[model samples]
Target: MYCEIEENWRDLDIRYLSFSNICKLNLLILDGERFPILLYDIPCALKVLHWTDCPMETLPFTDHQRYELVEIDLSHSKIVQLWDGKKVLKKLVHLNLSYCKELKEMPDLSGAPNLKTLDLDGCEELNYFHPSLAHHKSLVELNLSGCESLETLGDKLEMSSLERLDLKCCSSLRRLPEFGKCMKQLSILILKRTGIEELPTTLENLAGMSELDLTGLSWT
Candidate 1:
C-alpha cells in the first residue's frame, strides 16, 4: 500500500496499535477508550504523545528504557500509578496530566535529569509532590494550579534552575518553600485563591523575579 507517510496516523481511530506499526511515528494521540498494550516502543523521532480521557490505571514504563520522547500529555485520564522512583524518559521536557482525578502521588523523577517543566493542574486526588524534583538541575517551570488536595511540597526543593512556579487553588497548602538566599534565576510565582496565610520572608531574596502572584492568600 502506497499510503502517504504523513497520513500514517490520520485514521488510527480507536484500536490496539501494534507497536511495530505506530512506533515509528513522531506523534501519537490516544482517545476514545484505553487499550491494553504494554512495551511502548516509542519512536526515535516521537516528540509528543497525548492520552486523552483514557482509563489506564497503571503505566508499566521502566527507568532503563531509552528513547527520544519529549512531551507527554495525559490530561483527563485515569492513570493511577507510575510506581517507585524510575524515570527512563531522559529527553522529556514537558509533562501535563491535568484533571487526572485518580492520580495519587508524584513519580520519583531523579532519572529524568533534563526535565524542565511539569503541569499537574486539577489533579484533585493528588496529595504529595516528588521530593527529587528539586534535584532536577534543569527544571525551570512547574504548574500545580488546581491541585486542591495537595498538602505539602517535600523537602530538598531548592532548584537553581527553577524560574516560574504556579500554585493557584492549592487550597490545602499552608506554607511555601523557604528560599532565603538571593535567587537570581527565580522569576514568576503564582498563588491565587489558596488558603496560605503568609509568604516566606525569603520573598526578599527573589532577585530576578519579574512577577509574583499572591492575589487571594489572606489569613484574615
Candidate 2:
C-alpha cells in the first residue's frame, strides 16, 4: 500500500522524524519545491536523503555539524552548483549526483578522505573534476559518463586503491591523465561512445588492469 502525505497527511506542520521512519517521506509531495522540508529543523541524525525533483541550487550545509551521513542520492535534482570546502561529510562513502546537469564546477576535494565511489554520470554541464579530487586518497571508483563538457582528468590518478574508471559518452573529453605512467592501480577502463581514437601507447601504466572496456568508439 502507498500513502501520499500531501493528500492524506494528518498534520501539515510536522517537522521532525526519526531515522528509521525516513520511508514516510516518500509519501509527501509538494509542487516544485526547494527540497523536502521533512527534517529541515532537525540536526545530525538522518543519514540517507533522496530528493525527487528538488531544485536545490546549493546544499547550504557547512562543516560545523558532525553528521553520520553515508550514502547521498541527489540524482536528477535541479542543483546548479556546490563546493563544500570544509568537507562536512566525514562518513560519506558513496555519493551519487548523476544528471544534475546544471552543476558547473566541483569543489576542491582536499578534505574528503573517506569517499570511495563518486558517480557524476550524465552531468553534462560539469566541466572540471578538480585535480584536487586526487586528494581523496581512498577513492576507488569514479564514473564521469555523459559529461560532454569534460576535457581532462587529474595529472595524477594513480591511487593505490583506485580501480574502475568509466568515461563513456564524454564527447568533448580530449585530455586524459597520463595513463601508462601515472595510473598504476586502475583496472577497468570504460570509454564507450567517447571521442577517443586510440589508447595511449603507455596503456601499460595500469600494471594490474584486468579489463579495458572500450565498448563504443568512432575511431578506437
The candidate scoring highest on lDDT is 1
lDDT of 1 by residue, 97-172 (tens): 8888889988888777888888888998898787787556788888889989888886335777889988999999
Give the clash count for each candidate: 0, 2
RMSD of each: 3.8, 4.9
Provide the TM-score for each candidate, comma-separated. Answer: 0.83, 0.78
Q: Output the number of the TM-score-best candidate.
A: 1
Candidate 2 on 117-204: residue-level lDDT in tens?
Answer: 9999989999877876754567899889899988777665656567888999988876566653556778888888887766666677
Flag regions of model 1 displaced more than 4 Å: 1-16, 20-23, 37-46, 180-182
State the weakest 10-residue window (summed lDDT) of model 1.
Answer: 1-10
Clashes of 1: 0
